[model samples]
Target: MKKFPMTVGGEKALREELDDLKTVQRPTVIASIAEAREHGDLKENAEYHAAREQQGFIEGRIQELEGKLGSAQVIDVTQIPHTGKVIFGTTVDLINMDTEDTVCYQIVGDDEANIKGGKISISSPIARALIGKEEGDVAVVQTPGGGVEYEIDQVRHI
Candidate 1:
């Protein structure tokens, strides 16, 4: 499987989630299953069925988190040399060329991308265009509405 790039913060978040699933959720589901099993027959018990379904979901999520963590390549933006260019894990300040509206975005992994939080996925059109670009460079992003142009005002590694 191809390894996915992740920021140090993103890796830590995944690790924390994995720990929670293993130490908290897994044990809780197991106990719930045991209690449900003790209550009634295996075939007709609604509680048992529900517990089993919950167990399945918990196990599936655990596996997914483990796989993602195992294949993740964590990159620490702070440790990398600052070249004043846009790169993964870099927070960039931009100005819309058309409207002259200022915006800030942190380029991160797919799992860490949240538009509301000012984080954009590395694979996104805007990030792709910004990669390797320095301040004063213009990035043209192809959006569903149309093409949008942004001027890179600043890049910060944090």
Candidate 2:
């Protein structure tokens, strides 16, 4: 199996979710299903159907999280020595060459990528371009609009 690169924080969050699913959600759904089943005939039971659907969804999520955690290779950026080059789990500050706009992004695993959170996936175009690039290096990211050049200002392993 291919190992997925994940930040320490991401792994923790996933583990928490899995725990909640297995301990809280699973039991709650089971209880709901039991109660629904007691209510009426299985053929015309809306509550039972809804509960079953919810149980299926919860189980699916639990399995997904477990699989991800099993295949995860957690990287604690804070524990690693800070290097000038950009890498996974590193927060990089970039300056747009043309617009002169400065932005910061943390390269993270796919599960942790959130644009609003300033986290980008490792497979993203910008992150792929920034990977292995040192401070003062220029990374050109090809977007749907066009190519955008960003100057690596700083890289922080945090």
Candidate 3:
């Protein structure tokens, strides 16, 4: 099976969600189904139908989390050795050549990517272009808005 690459934090979050689903949601939904069964007629019982639908959702989520956790390959960014080059889990500071604006982004696995948090997926166009590039190198990314060049100002494996 293919391994799912993820940061330590990302793995922890998935674990927590799985725990909550198993320990809390599963039991709660079971109780709800049981309670709905007490009201008699199975065909016309809205409460029973609703509870079953909710149970389905809960079970599907539980399975998805389990499968993902089973194949997760957690990586620690702080432990990786840095050679002044951009790599997976490295945070790079870049300066836009045209706008002269600075942006810092942490190259992370898909599961750990949150653009709002300044973490970008390694497979993204910009990240792909930045990989293997050293500080002072200009990386060009072809975005939907067109090509943009960014000069690497600093690279930190954090």
lDDT of 1 by residue, 1-158 (tens): 79888999998988898899889988988898899889868899888888889889888988998888888889999999999999999999999999999999999999999999999999999999999999999999999999999999999999
Better of 1 and 2 by lDDT: 2
Off by over 4 Å in 2: none
* Pick by TM-score: 1 or 2, better one: 2
Query: Against the true structure, candidate 2 has what lDDT?
Result: 0.95
- Candidate 3 C-alpha RMSD relative to the actual structure: 1.5
lDDT of 3 by residue, 1-158 (tens): 99867888788898999899989998998998899899999899999999899999999998988888889888887898878899887899999999999999998888778999999998999999999999999999999999999999999966
lDDT of 2 by residue, 69-148 (tens): 99999999888887798989999999999999999999999999999999999999999999999999999999999999
What lDDT score belongs to each candidate, Candidate 1 first?
0.93, 0.95, 0.91
Instruction: Enumerate residue pairs that collide in model 1.
Output: none
TM-score: the better of candidates 1 and 3: 1
Evaluate residue 115 in candidate 2 and report its C-alpha lDDT on the 0 to 100 scale: 91
Identify the leading candidate in terms of TM-score. 2
Give candidate 1 regions above 4 Å deviation: none
